[model samples]
Target: MTAPATSSGIPVSRIDPYTDASILDPYHDYRALRDAGPVVRLDQYDLWAVARYDEVYEALHDHEAFLSGEGVGITEQLNKAQHGSSLTSDPPYHDTVRGLVSRHLTPKALREFHTYIQDWADRLVDELVERGEFDAVTDFGQAFPLALVPDLLGWPVDEGRERLLDWAAAGFNAFGPLNDRTRAGFPLLAEMGAFLHRMSVPGNLRPGSWGAELVADAQAGKIADELLPALLGDFLAPSMDTSVSALSSMLWLLGSHPGQWELLRQDHGLISNAFNEIVRLESPLRGFTRLLARDRSLGGADLAAGSRVLLLYGSANRDERHWKSPAEFDITRSNAAEHLGFGHGIHGCVGQALSRLEGHSLLNALLSKVRRIEVGEPVWRLHNTIRGIESLPVVLRA
Candidate 1:
């Protein structure tokens, strides 16, 4: 890759982050991005990237300067398409929309699912432990959320459960530039969006469920009718893969480092900490784009108005400037929770509590049934914005 300078004099790298190779293992490129400068211009995408923790964290919080309303993707077209989705809206508006969506997933609201999710995880782990081998992603990681999210939202098992995982993956893929991966998913995403819109009706949702609440809110004018579909999409789209990838990465981290797994098995309480560490080490949603709302100077570069800035969460979490030995996955690390793996600020992951509940519950269940988790070659699924193990071969010691 060649290093060139943009017209504004920001250091440029020819690395295309959306490419398959980069998505597979982005650390090398991440290190290069941070080392080159705080703001590295990606000539391939014509966007400036903020890879260091300081800048990324600042940009995440400073929604005024780095706006999400234009869309949080590399391509301008996605910004146009996803204009007012909770993920794409700015504050005031973002706060209102997010509040309406978050009412159902709040800690108190999700507490009911703790036992159910734990029971599900335990049952799944019991089967894996009995068999002695299983694919972690299919059998455990993705399986947990793929089954739970739709049910929690009260979608009909036959209608929505089967398609939840694919729709979530495709939704995230559309966040990137118009690459082959994004291109292939566009049609699927469109179809899924239409389905979600149609099924978002009150009668289609289970009574007293999250989906029902959202539909009721729309009917009562808590949020506009037009925004209901996007809000419901918000509840579904980002939840699946983000949790799947996080859980899968957590399993991979634990299985690969037997000592950590042993630590988790012994304490059980550290399951939450372990989840944080895993995401800190392998952030699921790699990075998101922010349009420069105004011309501003950051890290010695003068960013012009309307320019796209990539906030590298994966890079930021592993940045040496923020953490000591940032690359090492240490579950007991004191400040691991401070990582930007789930992002930072007001726009930080609203569903984080639910994700933690699912991960922690599953880990707790595994500790009770399995003594050791032996992992084989893990297969990575490449999406522009999400990093996940598609298949994780593992043998559990009962």
Candidate 2:
């Protein structure tokens, strides 16, 4: 994977991460980027590719230097479109907007839903086990979250419920460069934005629910009325597709590695570490770009101010420099939680506690109900930013 060097000696590659071929099987290109250098210049997008663990971690932590306010997407238009959302903003404003939703997502606040989530998981597992075969992605992965998140956010049972997955996936796609995949997402995103606007109004959201709280906040002049829709989306999108991706990947990994399944079954306590390990191996989000706020040297590559750099969280999790035998999946790996699968620092995923609860509940239910997991080949979905399975034939044996 020899790359041409710029006059500044930065290794350069024309690899387009958003290409259909690359999105389907990105690990090869990710490995190539990592091998080429710590910070390789992606000639195709004119963005710096930070694929190694150390560099990606540093960039995520130094939010001031590697700014998110400039927009994290690869395109200027999309970034501008996402201007007011928490995902694309930096501190003071970022902290204020994120705080409105953060209180509800914290571990302590979410404890009330523990039994509820567990019961749902058990019920879903029982149905899947009874059938003995089903598509893990649609049946279990997408099903679990779709059932839980909407009701939790107080979404109406009748309006636009079916399109959440598609909308959330498209929202992530808009983060990539202007290409067919990214261009195709704009319309869906517009539709989602419209739904969110309707959902954000008072009397539309169920009172006392997270969505309603945002409405109340807007009404009280805590957050602007226009920001309500984007804020609702911030809570909604991240809560769905990413969890679906991780949950589906969990089943695939456990089914493919029976020994790991047995290991998990034996000690049920390993469930938490196992979730971390799963995301470590199959990061749901391929990566998100960060704009350099100032001229900075990242991994020996001097990037100028206003430059965009893509931080590959998926690549960083599997970086050889950080993990021993990085590709090998071991639930017992003590440091699995250290993986950047959920990212790190201030910009780390705000809804992660809820995600962990969802994963833990499902895994615990699986451990008690099924003895063996038989899975056929997975049909991988090609999206700009989300790396997930579209379908996987699975048969569970009790």
Best by lDDT: 2
- Tens digits of lDDT, candidate 2, 1-398: 55679889999887878878898898899999999999998877878999999999999999999999988888887788886788878899999998888889999999999999999999999999999789989998999878988887999989879989889988888898888877787788889999999997789988778899889889899988888888999888889888989999999999999999999889998999999999999998888999988999988889999999999999999999999999999999989999888778877887788889999999989999999999999999988888899999999898
Clashes of 1: 0
**TM-score of candidate 2 versus the correct structure, residues matched by position:** 0.98
Residue pairs clashing in model 2 are: none
Task: Write one digit per residue (lDDT tens) for candidate 1, span 14-42.
Answer: 87777788988899989888988889988
> How many collisions per candidate?
0, 0
lDDT of 1 at 117: 84
- Candidate 1: lDDT over CA atoms? 0.84
The regions of model 1 sitting more than 4 angstroms off are none
**lDDT, candidate 2, residue 323?**
94
